[model samples]
Target: MSPQLLSLVTLWAAAALYAIAMVAWSIRLSRVADERIQARQGAGAASSTTAEAAAPAKERVAVGGGDDAAVAAMASGATSFVVDDGDETDLPRRSGADRALGAARAAMYSGLLLHLVGLIARGLDSGHVPWSNMYEYTITGSFVAVAVFGIVQARRDWTFLGAGVTGFATIALGIGLTVLYAESTGLRPALQSFWLVIHVAIAIISTGVFIVAAVATTLQLLQYERTDGERELTGGAIRRLGIRVRNGLARWTQRATWFEAIPSAQKLEAVAFRLNAVGFVLWTFTVMAGAVWAEHAWGRYWGWDPKEVWSFVIWVLYAAYLHARTTQGWLGRRSAWLSIAAFVALIMNFTVVNLFFQGLHTYA
Candidate 1:
C-alpha cells in the first residue's frame, strides 16, 4: 500500500483503540459506582437492623465498647466514622477498578503512538503540513487532544478525564474519516506560506486546549446541578440528547459518587478557567497572525469574511466569559455556560461557516 493508505489504516486503528479506551474507562467508573452503591446499601441494611434490635442490649453493648455498639451508633447517626485505608488485597472490587484504569491508560498510550505515526505518514505523503483541509485538521486536532490528555495524565492521576478525552478523539476521527475525508493533495495558493504552519498550528493547539476545558466545564456544570439530591436532568429535546449521551456510560455518570471522585465543582471551574485563559491568549495571537497573513495574500488587513467574523465572535464570547468570571465574580454555573457557548461558537465557525457561508476561508 501507499504511505497515504497506510496512514489512513493507522489512523483508523488509533480511533478503534481510543474507542476501546473510552469503554474501559467507562467500565472503571461504572464498577466503582456499583461497588459504592452496594456498600452503601449494605451499610444501610446493617444499620437498620442494629437500630431495630438495640433495645435490650443497647446499654450493655455501649458499655462493652464493641463493634455492635459502634454499628448501632453509626446507624442512629450518633457517631462519626472514618473509613480505613487498608491493603489492596482486602478489596477485590477496587483491585478490579485499578486493573480497568490501567488497561484504559495503556490503550490510550498505544492509540497516541499510532495517531502520531499516522500524522507523520500523512505529512510525508503530502509533502506539506497535513492540516490543510477539514479532514487533516480534524486528525491533527484530535491528535493534539490525546497528546494533551497524556501529558496531564503523566503529571497527575487524571484518570477521571480518560473516557472523555478518548471519546472525543474517537468521534472526531470517525467524522474525519467519513464526512470530512479528502484526497491527499497539495496546498492551495493562499495557503502556500510559512504563516500557514505557524498560525494554524497555534490555532489547532488552542482549539485542542479549549476542547479539554470544555469537557471539564461540562462535567462541572453537571456535577454542580447534581449536588442537590433533588436535581434532575431536565430540558428540551436537544438538552435531553446531551444528557443521554452522557448517560450512555452508565458507570461514569449515573451516580453522584462518580462525580465526587473528581475534584469539586469550584476546583474544576478553576482548572477550566486556567485552560481557557491560555487558549484565549493563543487565539488572540491566531487572529493577529491571520490578519498579517491576509494582508500579505489578500492585500488587506481586515475583511468582513464569514470566518473572520465568527472567529472574532468566539474570541469575544470567551473574553466575556473571563470578564464575567473575574470582574463580575460570576458563579460557576454561569461561567461554565459561557464557556460552553464559546465552544459552540468555535464549532460553528469550523462547520457551518466553512460549509454554508461564503468567504475567503473556504479551504475547509
Candidate 2:
C-alpha cells in the first residue's frame, strides 16, 4: 500500500483506540466516584451508630444533677469513632489498576508512533518540515498534546485523565486527517524563517499546555458543581452549562452513588490550579518569545496583531485566575470558575483569532 493510504489507516485506527480508552476511563472514573461516596457515607453512618450505641442510659444517679450530665458526656466520649483497619484501605489499591495504566501508556506510545508516520507521510508529500498549514498545525498540535500528557503521566498517577486526554488527542488526530487533510506542498519565502521555530514552537507548547489545563479545569468544575458551587460560580452561563453536564452525568450514572464518589472538589481544584499555573507561566513565556521574534522579523516588538492581542488576553486571563485563587478565601469553587474562564479565552485565542482576524499571527 502507498504511504498515504497507510497513514490514513493509522490515523483512523488511533482515533478508534482513543475513543475506546475514553469510554473505559469514563466508566472507571464514575465507579471510583461511587466508591468514594460510599466510603464517606459508611464512615459517617458508622460514627453515628457508634455515638448512639455509646450514649449513657438516662437513669439518674442519686448524685446531684451535675453528675448525670457528666456521666452522659463521658459515655458519649467513650464511643467516639474507633479506627477500623479496613477503613485505611480506602486510599484505593493502585496495584489492581496497574495493568490499565500500562495499557493506556502502551496505547499512547503506539498512537504516537503512528502519528509520526502520518506526519512523515505528509512531510514527504509536502517536501518540508510539515508545519506550514492548518492541517499540519492540527496534527502537530495533537502530537504535542499526547506527548505532553504521556510525559506528565509518567511522573504521577494522573491516570484518571487518561480517557479525556487520550480521547482529545485522538479526536484532534481524526479531525486533522478528515477536515484538515490536504496535499503536502513546499513552503514559500514567507514560511521559511527561523521565527517559525520560535513562534510556532511556543504556540505548540502553549496550545498543549492550555488544552491540558482546560481538561483539568473541566474536571474540577464538574466535581464542584456537584457538591458546593462556590460564590463565584454564580454566573448564569457556567452554571447553566454545569447544570446540563450534571444532569447528563446524573442520568448516565442513574445512581446517587456516582455523584458522591469521585475525587473531592478540593483535590480536583488543586490539580487544575497547579496545571493552569504551569500553563500560564509557559504562555507568558510564549508571548514574550513571540514578541521578540516579531521584533526581529517585523521590526516591532509589540503590535496589535490579532494573534498577539489574543495571546496577551490569554496570558492576562490565566494570570487573573492564579491571582484570584491565591486570595485567602478563594480556594474551591471561586478559583475553579476562573480556571474555566481562562480556557475560554484560550479557545478564542486559538480559533477566533486565527480565523477571523487577518493579522501577522494568522498561521492557523
User: Where is model 1 more than 4 Å wrong at Cα?
Assistant: 34-94, 229-257
lDDT of 2 by residue, 22-45 (tens): 665555565666556667887888
Model 1 lDDT tens row, 254-303:
35465645667887898789889989999999999989999999999999
Best of the candidates, TM-score: 1
Distance from true location, Cα of 42 in model 2, Å? 8.5
The estimated TM-scores of all candidates read: 0.79, 0.73
Residue-pair clashes, model 1: 1
Deviation (Å) of 200 in candidate 2: 1.1
| CA displacement after TM-score superposition, residue 98 of candidate 1 (Å) | 1.3
Q: lDDT, candidate 2, residue 351?
A: 64
